[model samples]
Target: MAETNKPTATKGVLSIAMIKKLIGAVVGIILGVYIAGIGVPEGLTTKAMWGMAVFICAIVWWIAEVFPDYVTALLMCSAWAVFDIVPFGTAFGGFSNATIWLLIGAFGMAAAVGKCGLLTRISLYLMNLFPLTFKGQTLALMVTGTLMTPLIPSGSAKIAVLAPFAAAVSDSMGYKKKTQGAGGIFAAMFLSLGCIHPLFLSGSFMCYSVVGLLPKDIQSQVTWTSWFINALPWGITVLVLGYLAILFLYKPEEEKRLASTMIKDQRAALGPMSKNEKYVSVVLVLTLLIWMTEVLHGINATIIAIAALAALLGYNVIDRNTFKSGIAWDAIMFIGCIFAVSGVFSALKITGWIGKVLGPHVAPLLAGNIYLFLAVLCIVIYLVRFVLASQLAVITIFTLLLTPLALKEGISPWIMGFTSFVAINVWILMYQNAQYLVAFFGAAGGEMVNHRQMIKLCVAYMIISIIGLLVSIPFWKLTGLIQ
Candidate 1:
């Protein structure tokens, strides 16, 4: 009867299709105009305009939906070859860069840790450090995340790995999810915080790309030592403050149960790390050592990652299908697309137009008011994710187009780039922006935290963002060697 009673509005059906078509058409038109310009002898093929349009759309698509980010990035690289925007060799150069290898190695290590449940062990071990109040676990988990972020670049994978521990805590506290007001909201917010760790690393994908755009002379100033100087302290400040705000405001329902015995139960299921995980760890550790000591010992990270991924399959740590399940190939494809599109920015002279458009307010926007500028940039980008829907899209659009303009005004593009990431991670306000939100549902049989609760948590997080930015930005400049 309920199935029969379902509304059958033909208009609703029509409207949904229309919305997608309308939006898609606009995207196509924008891409078309830019690509069309590539043919204009003087105006076209300059790589600035056309490459960027594809770059923009691909980023949007990857973020808005479940398409590939890596593929999009690679596509931008491909555009360089197709349009002769840059030497095909130079365009492919980025793929082989040490920073790219760092991403691959770090993620591979994370994957091994996740597969063998090392992260869970670490997570549970950390949980044991606190009083085991639900809040204690939440705070501990968040601290762990902040500690982990500089090392781990894939936010979604990190949160996915962390979710089980959070669930275990929720269960340990004896508070049923959803029935307890905002309990799951604590879960969501903590996950957001944990996912935020990569902001410090020059190796994080967005960080690397943004850093790549900096003037060559300024590049040497950012090394691993310098980036962490700023990021670690700032990340700690935000985590500490965020924990306080969340613990008090989103307090878990007082449980009659005690945690004195919970660790014993958790230990029951905790076994020795699996063999594959150990292999992954070894491979990743060895890889990172090579990457960090590039001056004395240079090893390619991508090759190492690909080799490890292949070796994992051969060794049966993960079978082919399982490996496929683990990697988001679509995202890889999307990254390629973005690379191809970014090529047009160089090909068509579009960047100049974008720069001029943003020129007037450049100085005043960032003129000696760094904190305010970054704060506003974060809030704006965070909100824009509602419509934009992809983290990569936000980076591609804002970083590529607006960066030169901000630089012209004496603003450090690096700082501006950092702000884009700070804003992007605060995706708690809207369901549309975060993969972690979706994971909570899958992990919990379709049950989810309330949107209103998320709103409250995100609102409080606005303050936390400022704290994070303040701690990290100057630290980057001071310590001066994190890239």
Candidate 2:
């Protein structure tokens, strides 16, 4: 047994994935430098060149999954400080942004709602009211998602609250996991979560963050009321179209009865509403009233959210520990990083530079045909979303880049902001969003959904989106959002 010597295995240094990421980082840095050097545009400055390099590297790391998104964000801030691209205070300034605090407050409120079983109780009550037909069941789920949007700013939280109910509904109907009924239910919830965010100012943290990024002059016009008025038509249109698409794509076999009593039983099991639930409900209603009446009160939405969160704690609906644990710190960090990056881009004048480079090329094409330009832009945004992972990230980056171009084309900033927000989230091709993926898998439970079925549903939704954009042009014109 001893005659032949065993060959010694080599101890590896970097794994293949790590090596690829390193190459990606290096290439990204080099590309950024090349862009800086070649950017002989009129408005661009030397500081923007360095900022571009850091921005590119950060994006590469984000796309490669080389590091966590927040970690990449932190690295970008650090790089900006280290390279003298911006001051340390400026780089980390996003942490202090009121929008970040707004998210924390909204998340805390959502946590309290979940903790008190308000979400489940409401969901069950809604399910009880809907007709027993398959379409009725789907509508119930969609309605639940829509109603939850104004309360729960976190999409993932809404999914968390609804996925179990959806599963239970499907199970009660004798539909197995991945069956048509189950898939349809999941799609309905998912699509509702996706489409309803832009409809309300408090519906998504991304909306607030976009507003924060706008210039002070334009910020006044991007109010909660304006956003709702401008975006409601498109949002409702997409919701209806998406619901129909899901039904068409995932037609559940005829289930003669939906077992309405199952949801009723669940509601009964929750017993009477607790005192805490009542308090939280009151607080939520008050918060929503304030949010919706921003025009009358003129109070900032962020302040209203914080005030509601404080009321929750004051009334013991949620304690300090609950509030602390409930807040999604990672999401806060990610949002902070996005705000920081946008701030640095503005400070470094990179946003201006982008306008200079693309203005001439895009200006002529957009001349005398703004709607045609917008239609094309909408399509381009959808295509670009394939590479990005986070809807928030997509909105932050593209909104920053494209807003200038839209402004140069003589479009209203409010219109640009609303359109960009909608375009960023119209993810109809794949479940790129983490929240959507969580909802998908959660609803699937043991039986995973068929990928092909999901794709078909997504394709139908995409077509609806395209048509919705075109049809909404007349509406936007009538509202004077687009002229």
Candidate 3:
């Protein structure tokens, strides 16, 4: 009788999924038709109408999860080409962007690090040092994640590398899934990963991509070191606040004399480091050194990443098969497609059209009040992430729309770009991105914590982030970034 019911249940789930997809399709088509039918304003090209239609449809599909994000990205590009919104060559041009190659290399290195057992060794070693209590274990995981940020540009990759060890540590400490202890552990991991992005240019692709969107004069002034200096204080503050918030909201039951033996035993099992580990370590360190000294060396960060990948492949740390299967191709493709579409916007001047339409109406209200403008802008961007799935997409779209207005209102483009990058990352729920989802569910197949608990913790962190931005305004002004 149980066996007979299994197939029926499976069919029920499939039917629901099919219905959702169909509804999403109908909604997307209707939205496209409605927007395309609207008349274009004076000084806007006919192509802008088609571009706007495709953009709306893509957003609808993305929010509805009508298709996988990469598939939606491909469909967007196809629409651009077929409708002559841009030339065929231009629509698919993201494949040639250097950032895509950088992502490939970064992801390849992560795979190599994971395959050689180094990631496990590092995580276990950290947890072992503070294994006596839940708070200590949470701090250890947070520190490990923070340390890995500069080396791993992808937050999802960092989570993928450390999540398994986090699960192991939680289980060994007798903290079962859905308990406060488990909730605290997962919360620490999630918040740390989210907060680390602003600290360094290499921390995430979103950081440098924002820099790329800046005007040429401003872009030339920004460097890896400058970005680190500008954002370090806020990033550290968020991490500290996140740690405290977790402890306050989810107080784990006291476990006196909890054994640290599991981590030690696992560390002992690994024995000594192998040749592959040593080689990957050396390459990672050298790559980081080069990335830090870009001012003196004058090599682009993307090129440095590619060279590191080549060294990994050259030394046999990662072979073709491992490299092919290991990289996050979906993420890379989505980024590339977004970048390509951005280029099309630049070429056709659609971004300029956006500024022309919205700038006059909004710029006058905030002309003399920089602080109020910054606060309102940041909050609006933060709230907008609820409907958007991709951080990169948010940064690309809103930055294009708002940067001109920011400049016209006497605010520095640098401040506008930096604040937008940070705001888009402030998510209150797991459905916002894949990294959030991974951290919400443990590496092993079970829910790590209750949804309400996670939401409360995220809300606290967002409040802290906003306060941090408000306090930093004077410092930014003194530093000549906002005159």
TM-score of each: 0.59, 0.68, 0.75
For candidate 3, give the lDDT of residue 238: 82
Per-residue lDDT of model 3, residues 439-458, tens digit only: 44324433556666777776
Better of 1 and 3 by lDDT: 3
* Best of the two (1, 3) by TM-score: 3
Q: lDDT values of the candidates?
A: 0.54, 0.68, 0.72
Residue 345 Cα positional deviation in candidate 3, in Å, after optimal superposition = 2.7
| Runs in model 3 lying further than 4 Å from the true structure | 1-4, 131-134, 144-233, 245-258, 367-371, 383-418, 426-462, 473-483
lDDT of 3 at 444: 44
Off by over 4 Å in 2: 1-40, 131-138, 144-236, 248-258, 367-371, 380-421, 424-463, 473-483
Stretches > 4 Å off in candidate 1: 1-3, 6-123, 149-237, 244-262, 269-296, 335-341, 365-463, 466-483
Query: Which has the higher TM-score value, candidate number 1 or candidate number 2?
Result: 2
Cα lDDT tens digits for candidate 1, 343-365: 33434555444444444544356
